[model samples]
Target: MVDVTYNSDLHFEHTLWTSELTFWGGELKSLENRLNELISHWTDKEVLTKLEHYLDEFNLQSNIVRDIQKSIQQHEINILDHTPNGSESMDIPRVKEHLKLRHKMEAQREIYGNLKKDFFLFSSENL
Candidate 1:
């Protein structure tokens, strides 16, 4: 019973993370397009440099989001495999792996949020 509950909770968490990351992936695409548009208007060396930096950061974040999404999907498969036959035996290593993924997701959210905030500030000041 406890194992079933834990599995359910983990599935729910993964679903939420997957949804949020998908939304963020689309946002990054939009931001990249906007940045490209801004790049055409800015000939100033310093502003151009800053725009390039943001573009790189956005690309990096997008990659991270994709990687994490893959990890989550793989982890879900692992959960299903381990729980086959409705066995009550919980895989300790898998549980630890889920915890690690949860931490990674939380850290990515904070880092990505900061990047967006900084990018917006730069855009506001330079545009």
Candidate 2:
């Protein structure tokens, strides 16, 4: 009974944390878009400096989110591993499903990778 309650509490906490992380990600993405737009329109040096500062802060926040996500994912995997009935095979089905979805996302991954690489290469040349 205590174990069940503990597991239930852990699950709820994990869910809440996951949702918060997702919300933060969305907010950060939206903020990035808005900042980009602002940077595009204004040529004032002071404003540009401020925008750069904001971007740095956003990047820091993003890094923190990524770290938290890694921790959360590790915890979730641990919980999955310790399920009742010694159901070790349960994770196999999830892995298979993830693999299937990953295959479907291969194109997206390629496009993103190319764009990211191109952006860095192009930006470096400009600098």
Candidate 3:
């Protein structure tokens, strides 16, 4: 017999949190540049329209990330805010906001997939 368990002692540091924020900012910029390149290089109006839609969705994701970062910084919220030893009471605003962004990102990932497929089709059509 084997026993498997989960540990609730896992915690992240402030540096990790800040690093994540920085990563997201860079990621958004990269995505924006990619979309702009696609729009400028592709002559297909339909494909350009699709890319625009994806860019709009990407902007929404960027806004959500920025909002979360701002909220955390403004409130001085740390990664352990929702941890067992971190907060004495049921303070879970950070956790809730993170979960919300995660859900949005999950949906955004689907849009990204569609964008990739469209770009592939555009490439093949041009060739």
Candidate 4:
């Protein structure tokens, strides 16, 4: 009973995380488009260089989002596999894996948030 409750809670958390990642993916796309629009209005060498940097960072973050989403999906599958009957004991390793995923998601959010702030500042000044 306790194990089933634990698994249910963890599964729900993963579903939420998946939705958040999808939203981040969309935000990155929108930001990329804004960056592309800025490219036409700027011709300074340094500005172009900074734009390139932001684009690269956005690409990297997009990749990270996809990778984390995949990991979450796989982890969910592992959880389901371990609890096929819903009466089995909780998988400690899966719990640990979830914690690791949570950490990665936190770090990704912080890094991406800083990048967005920097990019917005740059765009505002350069636009």
On lDDT, the candidate that comes out on top is 1
Q: What's every prediction's RMSD, in angstroms?
A: 2.1, 11.2, 6.2, 2.3
Per-residue lDDT of 33-97 in model 3, one digit per residue for the tens?
A: 88898889889788788778868876876776676556545434444444466443334565455
TM-score quality measure for candidate 1? 0.92
Q: TM-score, each model?
A: 0.92, 0.58, 0.52, 0.90
Best by TM-score: 1
lDDT of 3: 0.59
Off by over 4 Å in 1: 1-5
Candidate 4 per-residue C-alpha lDDT over 1-127 given as tens digits, one digit per residue, 9 for 90 to 100: 3533387778788898999999999999998888888777788889988998998899899999999999999988888888758464457787888889989989988998999999889878876
In angstroms, give how far residue 52 of model 4 lies from its true place: 0.9
For model 2, where is the 10-residue window of minimal lDDT?
Answer: 1-10
List candidate 3 segments past 4 Å from native. Answer: 1-15, 77-127
After TM-score superposition, the amount by which residue 123's alpha carbon in candidate 4 deviates from its true location, in angstroms, is 1.7
Taken over the whole model, the C-alpha lDDT of each candidate is 0.91, 0.59, 0.59, 0.86
Q: Which residue pairs clash in candidate 1?
A: none
